[model samples]
Target chain A: MGRRKVTHQLISDNATRRVTFRKRKDGLLKKIYELTVLCGLPACAIIYSEYKDGPELWPNLNEVRSILNRLSELPVEKQTKYMMDQKDLMNKMIQDAEKKLEKEKMHTRAMKLGLMAGSNDLITDTDCSEELARAADVVDKKLKAIRERIKAVEAGAPIIKRD
Target chain B: MQSSNVTDCTMRKRGTKRKIEIEKRMTKQQRSVACSKRRPTLFSKAADLCLLSGANIAVFVTSPDENSDVVYSFSGYSHASEIVDCYLNNKSPPKTTINPESAKFWWEEPDLYRDCDDLSELRIIEDRLMRTKKHLMDYLEKKEKSHSVSKSDQNPNNDSGSSSSSSQIASDFGQNPSTLSPSSLKIVSFDQNSYSSLEPSSQVTTCFDQNPVFSVGSESSSDQSRYLVNEDSGFVDGLLCETEEENNGMRLPQETQTQPMFTEEDQSFWENLDVDDVFGLFKDDNNLEVPLQDHSSTNEDDELLIDISEYLSEEAMECPCFS
Candidate 1:
């Protein structure tokens, strides 16, 4: 009857709790459907009434479930917005990673060049094979770094690239 | 008539009061209170959805009902154990953990079963991991041995020690290389449940292997044909062609660029699709079949009504999926 703060411990009035639940539950399911439509994600909601024997659906729950289930087919309305934002982040990460790898490779390359340039005939740093090995090391380090990042997903094995 | 209207008013007044009483039922103060009250009902709806859609759902309801009862509902004719299996495995997804697939492994190796020896015990886990590490080390040793023993001419430079490195690298290089590459390079076959990759080195950097790797098949055009249809080189070649085309107005040869034939993915999509699932793109067949009538037949020629059916059909073909 009056706008008072509701404690949620238990509705002190018996008849009021039932009424409030019915209205709020319907609204809850509606909110869920709206979210699924707008968000395009798989969401299965369960509702159990305090008085009722079991949980019950609002409506159109099946259509919503199926839509969410076929996730790949579902138009990723989030894709465009998320792509723009995530692209910047992911590209930044990639560039950062690439730069880090480049620094590592340059450092390795410089070390190998120093080794070759400074060698007085200890090991055969004197051949094309050593040059190939140096290039191979840089590629190997870069690829391993990338592989570790990509392996975050389940997909396995990477295609090799020759410089 | 006045008396009847009074009686009607009483009835209407009573009905209105009853409706208002119903509205006073559920709490709507804070968002969390609303969520807590309505969560169970939401789960119930989700269970119904799973049943109606014939989708396997294994729900791990983080919260309980108003009475503090945890309820688990799977699809019809499924065991509680299976549903629990799906729930505990937690592979459903990060978002949809509320719904999980049935425990029916689509395809898997047989004879796998849980041991009664303290399945949840930390000691067992530690022991299993230790055994795994030991096996891995042994495997690496064997691989290094094999790699060193490969064709005498292949790695004539490196001491035979690299043979074992090659063998160890073979599995890691082939298996999970992602700690590094986002490019999902896979060799998939319909018969195989998943890619049964060869053992790779633990490091995952064998892709830069000095020597090229090739797969052989038994008496099949899949491999060793006079014209090698190298799936790996094809990707590089495609990239190169794309780059060349971008720089110099040229395209990959039409023969090499034949679009992939229909695949199981397309077939699976069709299988999942219902007969009536039109996606609502087609307007009507009557419009398609109806020929454009000549309005100039009975009158002098003014503006010619071009038959646009051909254009419609042509546009329809370009619509890849519907066609």
Candidate 2:
């Protein structure tokens, strides 16, 4: 019969623990070696077992240290400073939005107060729409003027106005 | 007889279903044997993956012994540390997120955000003012230069009309005359000295005078120069350039815009990997097995004769999805 499936966990029994440790450790190293060879990747694993006085280092200690040293030498930005700058930018944006909201609120309040003082009558949708329509007409006229000026500039017309 | 066979089969099934209880403790011999077996298996798996997908890995495990810590290291390359370094180097600089230290309670908060917002708005206003001023200065400089040059080329009788039109054009470009004072004057003087230093020859000056639009776009051109230096100092330039691009309606090149997105994609790949998932691939029974040759044989021949091209390519194809 096939041996029972192995679940990865530590062994508590002294004899079993020692046996499992040796088998698993060897298996781990073999797997590492196979993966490194088959995939053509640079890989290393360091295993220290209680059974051995010295740790089992694949491809040796000097090489691993050099790899680690090269990693440490890389220029990565300081995490703390990066976080701080982000926070500052976000806070600034939030504050700007808040100020804009406050200004809008104050403007609405002023408009309401002015209307109340000017007349006892309430403002209707028609009045608001008429005012908006007038604003839109003015904006459209300005847009047309800007467009014409741009076209004139493109055509190399001599400048007539100073402002 | 058939009933007896069925009962026997049932008993076998029950025995197989029984949980394989592993002892909590192990003897010294068993631990040694297990460690030796597992260590080799781990290295082999690493080697396989490395060959298949061109991945680099380093595993370092420290086990506490009776006397001292035992260090076991497996590496795909000759030097294990190099792979470790490669792994570390690939990491993106810490992402900019919330900083708890800078956060204050509502009562303690100041008007710094609004102040910053105003300052930024002022900067944009200042920048536009500077551009207009630069354009005016260029026009003035050009007019003087053109007049001097055209004196020989064209009739001096028409100078009044042409000079008037040019001055009008320069003045028309600016919305507010008051914006010319204060910091803009400082920028104009600074720009003139810098511009003069860059092109001292009369020929270049005449060429610049011909293209007034060039001076209008000089702000972004100057910023692009700063961008090269900003790359060395983290992503502040990136943020600045984005805002500038929005204001100017300019689009950065495709390569530059797509680069960060690619790095972010890679970040997800690394961040999502767990230790269990990493080793689970090796434990897969269905995977193709490569024969474990003696280490001595491999050492004797510096090069491996086994051509894993077919298997490597197949595995390589599958790597990106898993990674």
For every model shown, what is its TM-score relative to the native structure? 0.16, 0.19
Residue range B93-120, candidate 1, lDDT tens digits: 2221121223333222132333436656
TM-score of chain B of each: 0.16, 0.21
Clash number by candidate, in order? 56, 129
TM-score of 1: 0.16
Docking class of 1: incorrect
Question: How good is chain A of candidate 2, measured by TM-score?
Answer: 0.40
List candidate 1 stretches off by more than 4 Å: A64-163, B1-323
Candidate 2 lDDT tens digits, B1-323: 99999778777895466542333224555545545555444544444333322223346433313433234554432344443433445432222122244555432445524556577776875687678789889999999997888775775555455444434322443424334222211111112324433422211111122322222223434433211112211112111112233222222222211012224445555565567776436454554233332434333232323455555766786777645
